[model samples]
Target: MTDQSPSEIALESRQAKAARLFSPSAARNRDAIGDLLAGLLPPSARVLEIGSGTGEHAVSVCQRRPDIGWQPSDPDAVSRASQNAWAAEMAPNMRPSLDLDLTRPGWDAGLGGFDALVCLNVIHIAPWAVAEAIAAASRTLIAGDDSLVYLYGPYLEGAATAPSNLDFDRSLKSRNAQWGVRARSDVEALFAAAGWAAPDRHEMPANNLSLVFRRRSPL
Candidate 1:
């Protein structure tokens, strides 16, 4: 057996290509992420995943937990192709990829509401506005009582640690002026302002942290 580079795996299809480009880490982290989700997400939850990158998480979540319905959305057409491919391959409780760009207004016109939402590594890659939009839109999507919003990614801990995150943060800023790792307190504040509250934080293998926020009020 051989491990393939993202470009090597991408040669399979358009969807695979997107997966290679965006979610190259899926093969490594999907299961760990799913473990966290299993505890947070409802048994019969409908999860709307924002920035579904390669759709790797969508497929893993649906396949591992058949009780949940997984919906993936991405703004990039090429990325959506990758997500769609995985959705077809898995054939579990999955929905087609949506053309969702949180930076725009009225983005959820046709998608409807969800019992849960998941976002992995999006906040650090995109502008602050992206995170802001997601926080605002979440209030409308989630169902009542324990409807979860799970965010997984590297973030600043107010204190600081392992030089890797500092380097990663620098790299992010270098790539895009608007992109950079955000503080945990800032993220929690966003949820709080939207009438959501944070649960306990879980540490992952990497410096990434899983921030769980749930809507406290009914829609």
Candidate 2:
């Protein structure tokens, strides 16, 4: 095959853009997260991802891990549209996007049971109550001890993870009175109260940590 001319390449690029739903963060860390999931997630797992945002991660993860089925949800219409558009190219394992808001009731019933749950970049951007609601929703959706929930994003300990995150947290608060970076201990307590425990924590690049929580089996 010969190399395509500039006009042909540009037309192909435009065609690809027409085919897409939307664009989001193409951080190298997405694959890193996928690597973590490869080791942590079981084969043939059913994963419900909350706040799928651009749906890029959802599509990539599902494509990379054909064994796992993914359900991507977001409260925003544009996000869902983007997710739907991106998912058009993926396998059937990628489920339809749902309008899921962690703050609301009845989401658990709607979502039903899942083997695992993954949420990225939500806790730090949402309110404290929203974070609690996520834990509660996880408890309701998981049926066994082996069920896992992975949260990825920036977190703060007594010491700041990075000056940039600290500044980002402050800016978030300034922009929205309800949004701010959450502390790891506080999040841990929320998980514990919701009958989940953390067995491992993976520190990612760019001051973000991937925290995995396991739901306690029903007594």
Candidate 3:
């Protein structure tokens, strides 16, 4: 038997209800994202997914690839609760969502070893420093030539910028000056500075892209 405070019990109840929150976009984009991930990730890999909003993608991707161990994380408490609930219902391989903030210096603290890192529609929602932190952390966490880091979102890529993405970028900037679509060249430069190879860009169903990066050699 265990003892619990009234506040602890109340917190537990709130968390249970929180899990039901859903994201419509997560459902729409999951299948397409999974298909792309299937080709990029190894048959058996430990994958850490950052900014696991509503936990839908974590559950969906893990269900598709049972061999992959999935760690879902987000800084938001509500998102963490939602992820925990989804993991409980759908994914045996999914671990409890961790409190992760990319703006912090030691963002990767306490996370177990992982072969790959996945971030979906996150960089555009946060400041550029967040992306840089991810790059720096990936260099520290992932090792060897086979390690991978995959980023999925809309980006400004030279003259190839779609009109829709341009509009989206404008809307994002309007919301927060620091938040907007990042340049592919800028992202590649960060990865290069961290000693990772240049990213391979894959076009997705929406105007989004999947940027796959790996190390040329162990760092």
Q: Which candidate number would show the highest TM-score if scored against the true structure?
A: 3
**Runs in model 1 lying further than 4 Å from the true structure:** 1-22, 216-219
RMSD of each: 7.4, 10.2, 6.6
The lDDT, on a scale of 0 to 1, for candidate 2 is 0.75
Candidate 2 per-residue lDDT, tens place, 36-83, comes to 876777778889898887777787787788888898988776667767
Lowest summed lDDT over 10 consecutive residues: which window, candidate 2? 6-15
Highest-scoring model, lDDT: 3
- Give the TM-score (vs. native) of candidate 3: 0.87
Q: Write the per-residue lDDT of candidate 1 for residues 1-219, one digit (tens) a residue.
A: 224221111111222343434454776788898777876778789889888877777777787788888888887777788788777766458788887877666677766568887898888888788889888778787766868788998888766655788898898888777888888889999989988876568888677788888766555
Clashes of each: 1, 0, 0
Residue 128 of model 1: what lDDT? 89
- Which of the two, 1 or 3, has more TM-score? 3
C-alpha lDDT of residue 167 in model 1: 90
lDDT of 3: 0.80
Better of 2 and 3 by lDDT: 3
TM-score of candidate 1 relative to the true fold: 0.86
Question: Per the 3 Å backbone cut-off, how many clashing residue pairs does candidate 1 have?
Answer: 1
Clashes of 3: 0
